[model samples]
Target: MTETMDRNFIWDFIEDDLANNPGMKVHTRFPPEPNGYLHIGHCKALCVDFGTARKFGGVCNLRMDDTNPAKEDTEYVDAIMEDIHWLGFNWDDRFFYGSDYFEKDYELAVGLIKKGLAYVCELSAEQFRDPQYCGDLTHPAVSPWRDRPIAESLDLFERMKNGEFPEGKYTLRAKIDLASGNFCMRDPVIYRIKYVEHHRQGTKWCIFPMYDFAHPIQDALENITHSLCSLEYEIHRPLYNWVRDNVDLPGNPVGFPRQIEFARLNITYTVLSKRFLRGLVEGGVVDGWDDPRMPTLCGLRRRGYTASSILDFIGRTGVAKSDSLVDIRQLEACLRDELNATAPRRIAVQKPIKVIVDNYPADKTEYFEVSNNPQDSEAGTRKVAFTRELWIDEDDFAEVPPPKFFRMKPEGEVRLMGAYIVKCNEVIKNTDGSVKEIHCTADLETGNGMPADGRKIKGTIHWLSAAHCEDVTLHLYNNLTTLENPSAKPDDKDYTDFINPESKIVVEHAKVEPPLKDAKVGEQFQFVRTGYFCKDTKYPNTFNRIVTLKDSFK
Candidate 1:
């Protein structure tokens, strides 16, 4: 809610409303359906709802749109609340569920029937959508039951609620224009019979109100001043207003709530559809909803993403009236920026090779002082143990040097980061013709200082005391989908076919500095020359790579 020079269109509308109606409070609501975990896509609407309230010094309510109990559960509700709190927003005492207003919803539907604005239709779902009923551009839809008596329709609706008829047997449809250009107004179904048990209301109700009908009623009943939603709902705005104008709710003292639609968030190389993400979890394509490779908020949290960084990314993306695909690298850059300035530095050798300092005493062990975070002055320093035997990353050495390779080579000198300068004298190979150990001689005079011989060492590599380090597991992650826009793939091919097989790479045994042994879950650190990583919350001694050190975003 920080004041920015460039105000988005939503803010402009709110400002105009306030100007026209003085003393009116700005109120909003975030109604997320509790069927699956929230992903980055939801975060945009979330910020717009809560952030607008904060800016206007008003109130924002959190509501669960759990009208459809087919897949609703209390577990997803709890996770939704947790995710909102993690983003540093709260609903205070203004929390509600769509099912809580079931009695009112039923009364309003009955009121519509009595006023001849609604009627009970006995057409099957498929039959209702057939060419005869669902008219094309040239002809209007025709329903035989459209002229049914109001009294007869009321009787049928009551019976439908009483569970006398099975689901899809009858639906209460609003008597709107059948030839309306917008199909949402073409006698939309206001209520349907669903025999499923509600997560909260239990078996008290057999028939539930559809979202299109229930959402406006809930907003009006809760006195929501503005109902901000995604762009897809823009076409349904007329119906939203119709429900508000017809319903006579005592709580709706502010007249009709304004409906505003904004563009949805779409990022390349990632899928944000809750249904698709659910498939990934249920089909065992991924570990679970919180898999580090998934785009769910919990997954990003496990991947070492901070709430501030996410908010920053959302802020940078800004509010738009039209949808556009943003590069995923922009999100990664925000995370990398925050982590670079906050995460402490640590040494980890994923592929380790033994380095034996021949000139140094076999039993000798020295300490080197290194900065925990060079970017932060108050971060201070930590002591790293330097022993005669050490473990260095295998990539830092080459027996037969490649072109422009400045790292440890035969008879070449390189500095051990924060330690002494060492020269590789010989390479020891195992019976299988692979590097087993490296023999080197250290310049004792260059301990924690440059050599007096005026020699410039172009290569510097991080090392860990072989005896003082701990073995841990490391997980490196890439894009979940190989294609930039998996959703736009050929219609014949499924989105799952584009799943990146190499999205997650695991290293069973990696050496880490002693300080990392006490690192708590959720704590992030920079792995020196490697990448940023965080301790896995669900696994022991496991770290997930957040992002590489190099920034690929401009």
Candidate 2:
């Protein structure tokens, strides 16, 4: 790996490891089990794993450790690859599966058995039930087949390979200490007789290696140098190494793959656990894994988040020791910052209020050149139609002003942005007590005044020509869960219980400027004062408001 003068801490650690062992090559791999869709947490992990490899000028392998076939499927594998590719990481033709090492893992287990290091355990499903099956440091639970003869183990294991065992009839256990302080060191089941089909290997095998036994060996077999993972696997490291030491390498796969742990990302307001997310999908609380309100990478992409924003978010969150939940606002800020510099400015009206430009001639219409970006001058400009009628945000005007409100009020003068200065001559109301529309007269010259002059208004607001506006499907998103009370346990309650019903608000036939009708999918643009938005990838032609320049709600 090539190191620049400003090396990140991860590089420093890798450099030290390599400095100590010059013979070893630096390689890293992101081994996500393809059991469920990846979430924001996985996005962060991907950044660390792949970004570190890129900086060091090394290769990062995308290995799907699909060891547990029961919960895994081809759907997951496909989604995983799509997410990784979307995040802009190519695994360098080193894509792999732990099942690729099934034969080796089985052979190694048999070797361990032959060497008296493992045995076939006959802990009946009843005996392996409940707390009795759980392992702990002080008191390790014993299995019935702990004392089984090596020959019996070999025979059962061979039969297991030959598909002679029923699913729960026998489990191959590594004969480690029964009372080690580390619960994993206690005699753990290395392989289980699972008669299930695998996504990649198909119906070729019945017995599968357990994750703990399969993962490290696959890394060693691939000659992987650094196996960076979330902190949860820190405890699993001991067993990770124990399997490496016991199983003699095939072709002497390089020094046992080193395991490093960093805190995993925990995004607040939405559940990140695969189990909980599964419940959300299966229970119909969410439309699916890719629901724009969900935090899956696909969901983020569909919700109009840029890959660079995600990567920047991950890098900024960085590695931590004690894990804490991050506010979703922080993520939105990254997008807002990214979009502000990239997206063009356009006017859209959600809950639109109609305004009649009483002074403009009915047949008159004109174009005012508006800059695409307010922050950058070189971003240039686009023309917008200023007709006799215009639409502004419904909330922009009030019949009786709320004191400090600057937008629009009875007799208030606010510039209809880029068009003309206008005064609210009247607030038209319905008998039902809702403001139907506002009547205004434009200052022809205070547009600087053939109609009026130097008219100072309290506020300048966005407007789209009523005659020239295009219909758009707009989606406004909010946090899925709504407990502003931060101390509320996101884990204790069913995630669905906390779900904000207003999370995904869809607006049909929302009016927008004529320019955005041809706006392509994933093209970001500022909707005037309405915050940052992009064409949703799922809808492509539809717009999704991401976040605003200011945290107005906060």
Return the top candidate by lDDT: 1
CA lDDT scores, all candidates in order: 0.91, 0.80
RMSD of 2: 2.8
Cα-based RMSD of candidate 1: 1.4
> How accurate locally is residue 249 in candidate 1, as Cα lDDT from 0 to 100?
71
Candidate 2 lDDT over 1-554, as tens digits, reads 12211345566778888788766667889888898999888887787787777876778898888888888888999999999888788986899887888888887888999999999988876776545765554557777678889999899889988887778888888888877787777788888877778888888888888888988888888888888888888898889888888888855334458888887787777667788788888989878898888889988887788888888777667666567777777788888887888888888888888888788888988989889897888999888888888888888887777878888777878877877888889877789988777888877775523333333566878888889988888888888877644346667776567779899889888888876888787788888778777787677448987776566322
Clashing pairs in 2: 1-56, 2-56, 444-450, 444-451, 445-448, 445-449, 445-450, 446-449, 449-452
lDDT of 1 by residue, 178-297 (tens): 998888999999999998989998898999999999999999888888899999999999999888888777655454599999999999999887888999999999999999999899
Instruction: Kindly state the number of residue pairs that clash in model 1.
Output: 0
Model 2 backbone overlap count: 9
